[model samples]
Target: MASARKRKAAAQAAAQGAGGGVLAVKARYDAAGSGRRMRGWNPPTSGPNRAITGLQKIRDRARDAGRNDWSGESSTQHWTTNLIGIGIVPRLRRIKSKNRKQELNDLWDAWVSQADADGVLNFYGLQTLAVRSWLESGEVFARLRPRQIDAPLAVPLQVQLIEADFVPLLDADYWPGMPAGNTIRQGIERNKYGRRVAYWMYRDHPGDGQLSSAIDASRLLRVPADQVLHMFEPKRPGQLRGVSSLAPILARLRNVADFDDNVLERQKLANLFTVFITRTMPGGVDGDFDPLTNLPVDWGNDGLPLAGLEPGMSQELDPGQDVKFSAPPDAGTAYPDYMRTQHLGTAAGQGLPYELFSGDIKEVSDRTLRVIINEFRRFAEQRQWQIVIPMLCQPIRDAWVDAGVLSGAISVEEANDAKRVEWAPHGWQYIHPVQDVQGKKLEVDAGFRSRSSVIAERGDDPEQVDAERAADKERDEELGLFTAPIQPDPNRSDGDSSGESSPGRRPDSNKAKK
Candidate 1:
């Protein structure tokens, strides 16, 4: 503690301070009692007082660095690999309604089937690539193109998928020039109502710096909102660009991976076994003699020849003259424990069971696995309905309808009214098939679920199932094939004193023959 004299000296020194000179600080209990603790922070309110926020404040750094990071790419790629498993293709089916017209429904169904077969939805392998781009770069672009009349597309529309790297035509002058109606934010142009009007896509991929590239135009193409579909999961209420799913898991995953690498390196170095040789003779050397230097050395009553370390086998030596071996310290506890803990923590990001990620299911019971997977499936279903459905399937459906109408294949009224369809995503295979089938059968029998709904849940269209059955039956009848043979009643074979017969066969069959 400083005395009063010290405080007075510090105050006097502060008073006598020169202009632009450093001030001496006195260490005390409450030296900063002169309002150093701030109450509330007030941000700047400069700029336009318009209804919409000034765009300059919300500008973010470019996403290139984030996407290119090793850890970021790995986590995103891992999640994408699982989420986009075998590609989530469309299974267009009509949703029956009370006011539904059979002819209109059939028209929609036929158009979808024909368009699917014609490869209208096959936009540069849109099933996998688009999903991968969306997951990796936080968004993807789908631009509608005129279908070639001579091409196999039944509809007059086809799609071309573009990556996010090529679509965001952002520059330093993009956001700040918003009030003057100059540069657009990111690649999206918004109106006075904060509604997206159009996208500014590059004529070619920006990442392509090659001289001999087919796409060389550096100009921006203004594609209207109607013709372009931007697929991304919006994080904020007014978010323009999506943040990558890997953004959160990058550090944790990297730490785990780095830890494993360290352990592995240490283990390898410890395994590099070395051999040390020594001699045990009285007048030969002062200490342990080098065997290479003393080839004619003699051993004095010690098994120095046979008990010595081998060349390429065991390693270590405790004492040069004591004939003892040194042992390395243990590499530490079991590595699996650490890995399992880290994996369990990060597996939630993948929205899958740890067993699926690690391929380890030793402790997973049937019921437990079913519960875990069923819960995880809810996340997949939510992602499908929220992001994939609206961004991908619906846009394609609208385009398909418009194409049909433009080609005079369907009237505008029919295209608009009967265009409603149900998209069934692929279903998961059950762990226990017999139990699952029984549960489904009970659900159908108890009227809790319709047969069509049950079939649809299995990733199959009920109409297709029925049609296939009908065709098979018709073919069998045409070929005069008897599929089922008459079966004698095993329980009542001619005679049985008891109402119920023994398990295998009727006991009275021999009696009846006699």
Candidate 2:
């Protein structure tokens, strides 16, 4: 007892030496306190802390859910279709020399056609794959492979896509050949100042073979940081890696899917029209009863019973034997409403509108749909510009230009001039075509928005659109075709046309104008 008291005193003294005394912090937030409501509410302090322990398991489950669950697939497809669409086409910007700009643009177009190291996917297709993988696996890597100078290519640069699995989440105090004072966290090597210096990656995917041996230092390749492109949407300030977009909703998706399957099975059983035979006495049973047909069962070659129900079939029952039909409960009328509510949660978790994600428009109105779609478009635009453009597309562009300059295919001056570029993502179709076009026209006419900006928003180059328009006009002139000048809608009496009502106007509008 005296030794125990001495030990406790020593511990207290050590605590006092470190600081003034043992600090007892009481959190003011009710949620952070050890209250009844806060029971089982322990959460990690940061994103990395939460992700570091079970990242691989989370990624594997997410990929499985994406493959199996409808909601998971919907989330991936919604982002890919909206954020990527056909492709985010590039437009060279602000090149003083028109000839140089055209040449650089043409060269870039050619290089992108065969950018993939495997020669299977183009650059834009790689973008789609990267985005899909990012959603599925949380993060993806691209190795910038500089080709030989004499290689037969427009630009001597190719991109090799690497899955997140390539980089092992190996947190170590000191790895083999690691510089002093640098620590490895989640497979990334960081120097003293916390700058990522390199990545420890496997030469081949560790999960590629079933008989894969235990990973060792020899199996890891230290790749320079600049050569690899890491694409992931970071949810925390100092997150070392990404967690799958489906991670948050995976359990919910599985629960919803299981419920749906159960409901389906219940409905199927409910419609089975099964009849059960009850026997009163022993030794009175003649043959096995078929639940499906309520007829005598026959054995097959495999010793399994085969039963059939034919129309107008009659069966004889022994004495004291009676038949009762099965009346299994259906999936209730609330099933549809319950499913809709569950799907809404999944859609919100995926950052998508319910209508777009689930393809359910039974309860959607035009105005409500318009609002939902606009909000979704804003979300997609943020992802495109912030994550995809800067992380994936711009780096590839810069690498292409550098390769072109190095390979002597492009002059240094031209490469420098063509550095500025604009990547335009595909535009969405108008919800109300006529109204949308008229609104754009009004905006353009009133100088509230520029015509160039309008064209760009439609995923077209303004200069190219103008040139196409000029060509069409020239062709019409050459063919002597009468082209009417664009005018305001005859039905519109919004005071822009002297409040005049012309042909095709409503009688009430004309009367009011008169």
Candidate 3:
């Protein structure tokens, strides 16, 4: 049977070769074809084209949903909470001079207190706002504003945040003159090599009627690309702009809201206790009965027929009359389950765990929660390292250093050296404090991790922590307080001079007496 199958395959290949060369596979992906399953699956393949045509409407719809819908608002808040809890603080990694590094740090702290161009938020507050905006609007921009040398700032630099609306997503060929190979696509002006040269932005927000009139709204400013920081997570290879994080789940959120409203309306109608009376004969109270339809002819003060029900009150029906109550349709027993499923989908689309998104942890065990959170932390770390740090924090660091040098606060020779920095983002809280701490201790004891690394992971500077610990220890000793001995070196021999024994070693009884 195997030989016959092989012979058949060889004959088919030979026939194909004889007809032409090797024939292309005629089969195609089912999803790519035009069957009923794929009929509504068509989406635009070009990211930039979509941005140019429909980005404004998409952004507006996303903002509307975010502002009005609870789940939509919660998703953006959760992202901001996780990504920029306190701030991604920067540490100078200068090895040549410790004093210079301290000076730079001091200057940074002073400047951070006044980093906002509008003077409304501090550096960390700006971070939170920037992350929130990026999540809600799909993109955020910051212009690096330079101040004079005599300005009352440690560093003559402040960041002015620009909303995504400031930059118009319109395509244009070179503004009619100078350069040949320059064209603007989606507000970003690129040269021949496709490197961004500038961004064409409105001087004032187009939506702010007070800030921009119809006459001044058309005026645009060409800002150098290097002077602006654009923060967004790009989904495609050449996506010029970002689409909202809420984009995928907008329709679902709207549907869920509508469903909730409908359910509430049903409950409201059910509470009215409306009753219908049917009569076999048309004889009843003359003023209360309609002559034509025999329905209620008396109208309430509010202009509607109302049947009032009072406790312990009974009314006798006429000779051949019956009464029945109207029942509004109720959301069935599956309503909660259906809502849970929809909420889970929304959370997943927003790249969040259901437990975090809904604050519903009744069904999740601790172990399961740990797994969910750890997976989420990995994603958060990726965003911190890949997007937040590189795009926002690092550029701000470089600009601060340059501005410091220009203002004579930092030496020109040390400007490049001072720019060597490492960012430590706000750390996550322990899932189970005691268990997590013990696990970390074990890792440290086994030499699998460093104490400095543990400190950094807890959202602290390792060197600063060590220095503070040393100061506390010295103060304790000077006040005649008991100082616990430091842990013995695991690699030290039994006869080591420090007089502390290794783990599990028996203390010398003779030494106690001496």
Candidate 4:
């Protein structure tokens, strides 16, 4: 087969007309006894000229017939026939194999490089390429997608630092009454809330990190620890209070336009607060009264033994010396033996004063008042307590009202009385008539009453009743439910046996015979 194909190819390439055979010749014969007109040529008998003319005529006729046939045929059939005549069939070849993978890679590279050169980053293209590469290579792309590359990831450092510094200060200052043990936790909670507020403020206003931090600190200081925890627990997205509510307040404090600032500020602040609060409290105040101090303490040691005398005890024995013990113990002396002994005594005394000889209760009260005032001053300086207390207290008052602790326009006693009355059933009375009317009852005949008393008393006539019954019987017969009395068939028909016959049909002939 290979050799035959080679030979055929060579022959065709040589171009001596496809097949090796010579062309066929046309057959003709000379006729004798021709009409005599001129000497050599016979006068117009059917000669080669006539024969050529006849052949030309036949060729013209055939061409005209083909044209007519083509015109008569449908356009689709004619096109198909023309295609066949031109040997167009059996010439179609399938497309050659393509390097689709390389082509795709080249297209992708061209788009990416063009974008990179123009400084116009194509995020979608980059993402697609990364995903495609991962799918093809079974490995995640080492390079970042456009979105990942462009996205701001780290929280702002300044915001975080501000939260760290300001929140603790706020807790120390504004919440002076809060025990030291709980301070860290409270501060952390407040920090979280304040950071949210600050985020709202600085989201649009950049570069005021100091002011924003201060506002956050102030808010943190002002927010009660309990309230902060309730609002920020579970630390997931969308857990924060409505931005609409928090944003305006934060914006006013930060002196900014709106709350569309960088989210990193908020996120960093949140994370910082979370970490700060989750950690052990400093100063041994852990939201519970310390058994030793009978004062709020944190999770830290504070140099005071758990079973020792109250914290802040002095070595001086005289009552006057108690006044001299106002300051915290000097550096290394904070946990002195005398202070520890006093702390143990205080703890044993159930937080009562161990000795009246040490100092007057009035003096202690005075010292506490001073500490509170100084803390307030610190808070004010830090700008953490800028909000008026009365305004902040409004929500608590509203909460009380909502919880039904207070009534609207009524005393508590009166409201209680109203509620009781509403729950009691009303309309609990009954009565009966003392007398009844009597008369001769009019008789109804077959549910129809007569206009004349005598006619109604007489009742219906017998003849009319019989006629009505007959008419009812006829109506029932017309409705096909009853039949008039019929004479028996002489043939004693057993009725039609075929189920196709209706009740109205006459008996079948076979039945009549039976």
TM-score of each: 0.66, 0.83, 0.85, 0.13
Rank ordering of all candidates by TM-score, starting from the highest: 3, 2, 1, 4
lDDT of 3: 0.84
Q: Model 1 off-target regions past 4 Å? A: 1-124, 148-152, 169-183, 210-219, 278-330, 476-514
Stretches of candidate 3 above 4 Å error? 1-28, 34-52, 176-180, 210-218, 274-285, 289-307, 314-327, 483-514
Worst 10 residues of 3 by lDDT: 501-510
lDDT of candidate 4 over 140-240, digit per residue (tens): 21111122222231110000001112222122323433333332332332243334221211122223344443534323333332232111111124332
Compute the lDDT for candidate 2: 0.84
Candidate 3: tens digits of C-alpha lDDT, residues 284-370 = 545566423456677879997655556886777666777787887778999999999999999999989999999999879999999
* Candidate 3: residue 478 lDDT (0-100): 68
In the predicted model 3, the residue pairs found to clash are none
Give per-residue CA lDDT, model 1, range 78-130, as digits (tens): 55554555555444344344334545445544544344333555432464567
lDDT measured at residue 392 in model 3 versus the true structure, 0 to 100? 93
Q: After superposition, how far is residue 448 of candidate 1 from its true place, in Å?
A: 1.3
Give residue 447's error in model 4 in angstroms.
42
